[model samples]
Target: MTENDSSAPAPDRAPALPPVADRAAFEAELDALRVREKAHTREGDAIAAARRRLPMVEVDAGLELTGPDGPVTLLDAFEGRRQLIAYYFMWHEGHDAAGQCEGCTWVTNQVRELSFLHSRDITYAVFCQGPYEESRRYREFMGWDMRWYSALPSNNELLTGRQVGSMHIVCYVRDGDRVYETYWTTLRGVEVMDYNYALMDMTVYGRQELWEDSPSGWPQTMDAPPEHPMRTNGRPIPQWSRIEAGRSDDLTPGP
Candidate 1:
């Protein structure tokens, strides 16, 4: 029968499995891996310590960003907090919700709890690249409650020397009225906001993506279509749930 034929019986295939081992053998292997994992964790802590000591650059505190209450300065985004974590959300000028950046959606969707950050005097917000009203609707559709603002007018000044259209996690601190950019990271660096990836890393298949080094016969279709792994059925994977829940993805302004 043809591959697409419904009447075709499923081909008999052996399941890909790890070699069987006794409980003691498995525990011994796990114990050895724990040593490497502990070392890796310590290295991560060291890197963060170095990051904390890095010098910061002064930014135009008065740079304009459009908020729900109209235009506001970058300093205002801190909301009286000592520090701010602004996510520069990539935008498609005229794309609908389904056409938005899947990677950004994936990371942004995972940021739900802010009280933990707030307790440490840090505020988290999104500085979107699209128009305020247009992107605000998208935010509403996705049920995101984080502070949202349009950084389009101040993109050049706010993200100087950085690619403005890409996703970024910029950290800032306020000294009285002066705003200083402490640190910023993009690309995989933004994975710090993702719990899914962290959990997937613990799985036997390890994200099940093309880049992972897996045993033969392991499934690697997580990167299917090869271009957008975070997307499914022409939309970001998370957007499908919002759509199914009867939320509006229309970005157009309402009457």
Candidate 2:
């Protein structure tokens, strides 16, 4: 093993055996698991149906945002498509601003294979919750090139049932050329970004969330600290403005 791997492969070599084995039991178990999972899903589906029927109040106000390409409209954000999902990334510039909302960054990191989401005609992007001029720099510094725009005025429309300033998920469906704010949920909705983590945390496979069924099982990683070199250059990077100005190399997450 090398420094990175820390473990060596077994030196013993054994004759390969035929791979064929009884799979009926395994198949049955997998089928049972699927059925059990579907039961859990049905509850969510029922709630979603009720949420969908909830009356939607229209807002005449429009918001302006800029993407990697340039200035774009809220409707243009749909990119002539149907359906859109936006993550409200809280970005208030500061060094390792936990104020950016750790959960928001966690969800951001968890997103994967969005091309499938696109194939489903779902246009997903991040609507940054801050001044574009301020958030843009941090976005670029973090190398996040997604469709980001400012939360002009305020993001009240997207965060109806959610607490003010809380991390959230706002989903929309575009009809024809117009966009309609469909289902939007905060707190719990962010779980969709966790991929398989939450699902696997049960019984023999417990969730990484704090209250694990098995105390014997190792605890899941709850807080993921910033990875940027703790100390930049010889100076501490205490502000996003400086880091965006090519001073990230000088960042030092407070000692």
Candidate 3:
């Protein structure tokens, strides 16, 4: 076929297909990978089992937080539920909602429906590391109707040895007025908060993060912001949509 023919591959770009092989051979390779995939899934199950078996630590039940209705204790966050899942949202202190932690915003946006969590006798809440007035405004700006609280006053008591401004997913069990911290995780462990990343993981591009073991010629922009998956033009990707909708992101001072 001529170089310009439809069957001919583009000259400049790398071939957009996997290594050439017969159909049967390709199936065989995929089958081999399937074996490993199954094993990986089983391993994940084992890890989860171990996590469930982890010993819990008692937390300060009397720790005070600022909620919509004013001062409340950690136990109050449970809302009479058996369990509580608190997302420790990072904040820019003086920055507007648009300048809030992009990674936090992306994950927070994933939790639109709390009925599933509520059905399991669990309550999910955002414990922002900033003032209630500014942070609650950020929550409203993002259209998040879930329970929001300012953990800034109780950060030292709630987080203990952990860094105050970092993102964390902390699980707690409420027994009457007492609260116990069952599990806490950060960084990649918080990926469970993000359904978008889970969906992206199933795609051919696979998150496009530099750390993924993608095949050669795969579309991975390595130098892009790895921490902020939905970041664009120095703002969270969703912030642009909010701005387009005429929603004001100015919750605090400055950008």
Most accurate candidate by TM-score: 1
* TM-scores for the candidates: 0.93, 0.63, 0.88
Q: Which candidate would rank higher by lDDT, 1 or 2?
A: 1
Point out where model 1 deviates above 4 Å.
1-15
In order, candidate lDDTs are 0.88, 0.59, 0.83
Ranking by lDDT: 1, 3, 2
For model 2, residues 1-255, the per-residue Cα lDDT tens digits are 332221233345232333354799768777899998899899889988898787654432245566656567677777666777888876545444334444566567666567888898887788877656656655555556567777654566545566656666777765565556766677657877876456566544354344544444344433323332212222222233344455443223223
For model 1, what is the error of residue 105's alpha carbon versus the real structure, in angstroms, after optimal superposition? 0.5
Clashing pairs in 3: none
Error of 1 at 70 (Å): 0.6
lDDT of model 3 at residue 90?
Answer: 91
Model 2, residue pairs in steric clash? 83-174, 201-206, 201-207, 202-205, 202-206, 230-252, 232-250, 232-251
